[model samples]
Target: MKLLILLLAPLFVVLPIYGYQSENLIDFKIKDQFDKVHEKSDFSDKIVVIVGSDREGSKYNDLWVKAILDSLEKNNTGKHVSFIGVADLSAVPFFMRGIVQGFFPSDTTKRILMDWDGEFAETYKFKEEHCNIAIFGKNEKFVSKYPVQKFENKIFEQILNDLRKLFSK
Candidate 1:
């Protein structure tokens, strides 16, 4: 009985546990098709442009989304931009490209955070649930939020201008 009690005591006792993972382990997370982990800390040192749109939006707004993706993928410009997707995790496995097809031409700054629950979007004040894009500064702070359905070239250009300012500083 003492032996059993001793054994059970260890089981019941709360002690330091090893190898626990964080739910928001942004660092070292693999992107869509790569053998790399997305590092969250990296954004602190660079400007990030995140896009989060899913479902029907991704289908109908493919062109516009692609344009954004293409812009991100441009030569030597990605270092200053990051994209975060706030969509269904299941869908991410299948349609990361559908959402990021053109936006990920390159990995210049590597600041993409895929927020499935829309927490980040909500915090950034984008409730349109369509083509939403936000820019985070080198301080790892959100500087702007732009929703797609209500966007004009001016807004996007303004976002670019904001990004340029971040770089300039």
Candidate 2:
């Protein structure tokens, strides 16, 4: 029994991490700030960048969302890519949601997706108290995720390099 338990314990730890690594993005559907529905297929054949906070109070909104938007807009990647901002709106009171939604930037360059119930964040296993960014490759598989304490030029460089590699493949 001890031998069997020892063998199974490793499986318990490895399985969940394997599952998270193998999960694809096809199961999600999100709405843009303009209320347009975008499915995972919309990102097919393109590298996808998802930037947002999984937290309740929109923590680090300025650092994560704004900096990513600025970086993407300024960089000339020329590679096919889609930038989506995810905001968990379930934290706000219902009455003020409309007002809060209106405050999302109306930039034509990128689209912000509203996650009302935090389902998207939950699905991606994002930390609930900090901002993070996820990169999905052209194959629609999750590549990597980064938790941001701050955004700087180096982060932008890494993102662009990843996009280039994805574009090449």
Candidate 3:
């Protein structure tokens, strides 16, 4: 029993325990694909939307982005909302980072932040193999995290309704 406990202790220390904690998001600094540093302070006084995904969940990111963008355009709420994309690259080996980066688009308009160490994902308790959507109101106050296993209209509408309520306030 002692031997088994000793062996498993290291795993517990190394692996991130996933759970949603209701607390304000602490400050963090991370670089985007364009090497632009984005910190919590940068999003002050804005309704920030953070869309994060691992490699498997990445396919659904664009659909969410499009839906959010379309909603913003239709409601003329573009100025109130800020979108940030975070790619969970913790699984990518160090040597493969450059190769993986090469696969990203060259567009300068949108920024795709890289969570190289999975710190952000762990902090947010992101669901594996699913798109994670977190919204923060002004002053870095965490509003909610939408569990998105796959794109669904009902879930999307709920998100939009929450955003609309936030915008109205």
Candidate 4:
């Protein structure tokens, strides 16, 4: 019984983000590195891309975030996609965001922010999950969510395809 209880314990964990609702996705006040405000609704009628990342100082995050951003750039849709760094929202280690940034090119299209406490992560349910990409419609409705690593000829490709679908509607 002890072993069984231990195994089952992990199952009860609750994800930070309950789920995305299209209606609740708009009129946003998300922070930018410039200490400016980005209205979630500005992307209204456009697709909103939100990435929840943990500030782990590893080459893995760099590769993943870069790949994710690169795919967004190729998206034919004119929607705005943002990649929020874990450090910006929470108290992620200083070095971790830098490491992820290093992997990316200077002119990358995706906008990245430091998520220090990961309010965005939990709001988007990124920490308890992997590849927690959420697509909100122009009307601020939740459309779709996909894992970063699963499909796409590559992980990033899959993300782009999802974006196309998001903006196509």
Residue 97 lDDT in model 1? 48
Q: Is candidate 2 or candidate 3 better by TM-score?
A: 3
| lDDT of model 1, residue 113 | 43
Per-residue lDDT over 97-118 for candidate 4, one digit per residue giving the tens place of the 0 to 100 score: 5554455434544445545455
Model 4 stretches with alpha carbons more than 4 Å out: 1-23, 57-75, 78-88, 92-111, 128-131, 149-158
Q: Which segments of candidate 2 are over 4 A away from where they belong?
A: 1-22, 54-76, 108-110, 152-157
How does candidate 3 score on lDDT?
A: 0.83
What lDDT would each prediction earn against the true structure? 0.54, 0.70, 0.83, 0.53
- TM-score (C-alpha) between model 4 and the true structure: 0.54
Candidate 4 local Cα displacement, residue 127, angstroms: 3.1
Query: Which runs of model 1 end up more than 4 angstroms from their true locations?
Result: 1-39, 60-76, 88-116
| lDDT head-to-head 2 vs 4, winner | 2
For 1-169, candidate 2 gives per-residue lDDT tens digits of 9999998999999876634433566466878778888787877887887776754534565666566556566765544677767887767787886888788778855567888876666667666666667888877888877666655678667766776677668
Clashes of each: 15, 0, 0, 21
lDDT assessment of candidate 2: 0.70
Error of 1 at 26 (Å): 10
Q: Per-residue lDDT of 1-169 in model 3, one digit per residue for the tens? A: 9999999998787664444454676677998887789887887788888899898888888888899889888989978888888899999999998888877768987688888998768788877888899888766778888858667999899889878888988
How many backbone clashes are present in model 2?
A: 0
Model 2 TM-score (2 dp): 0.68
Q: lDDT: which is higher, 2 or 3?
A: 3
What are the models' TM-scores? 0.52, 0.68, 0.85, 0.54
User: Of models 1 and 2, which has the larger TM-score?
Assistant: 2
